[model samples]
Target: DSLVKQIDAEIEKYFSGENPYRFTQESRELYKSIGGTPFLDGDYTVFGEVVEGLDVLDRIAGLPTDSHDRPMQNVVILSTKLKRK
Candidate 1:
């Protein structure tokens, strides 16, 4: 979807638009190239980032999902740790 349509969707679902403080053209481009859900830009809380787990992420993403988009088997998160710079 075009950027305008994505913003329109956010407004339609949440009755408000993207957070002006957080939304930007660069972010929009990142979302587009990364297969992200742009409509979630401001409405969702970011849980965490996979600083060192691209292969694991890819493996999980490759898992088969059910009709509702849940993984067919339970995928337990083994652990999480903050990676300090």
Candidate 2:
């Protein structure tokens, strides 16, 4: 029982934090104009942002969807190649 209690305490600590919303300063600004969800700020893993093709993403989001929000028509990705600066 003591060992189980220790493990539970650690688990709780891992999920606990002072702020429910967390983001970089740049991200915080983006939250205003572009947008963001403060409620889910720290709950997700943000790898990268779409620096390009934002218009395409907007178009896809505007596509028609069903009751479940799945697009009624399949949106095909033509290509994705990384451009080195």
Write model 2 residue lDDT over 1-85, tens digit each, in one string: 9999999986686577545355789878888888766765667977666778999999999999997678999989998866655
Q: Tens digits of per-residue lDDT for model 1 on 1-85?
A: 6999998886676645434355588876887788676556568988777778799989998999997678999999988788666
Evaluated at residue 44, the lDDT of candidate 1 is: 98
Q: Which candidate achieves the best lDDT against the true structure?
A: 2
For every candidate, C-alpha RMSD to the true structure in Å = 9.3, 7.7
Q: What is the TM-score of each candidate against the true structure?
A: 0.52, 0.43
TM-score of model number 1: 0.52
Off by over 4 Å in 2: 1-45, 83-85
> What does candidate 2 score on TM?
0.43
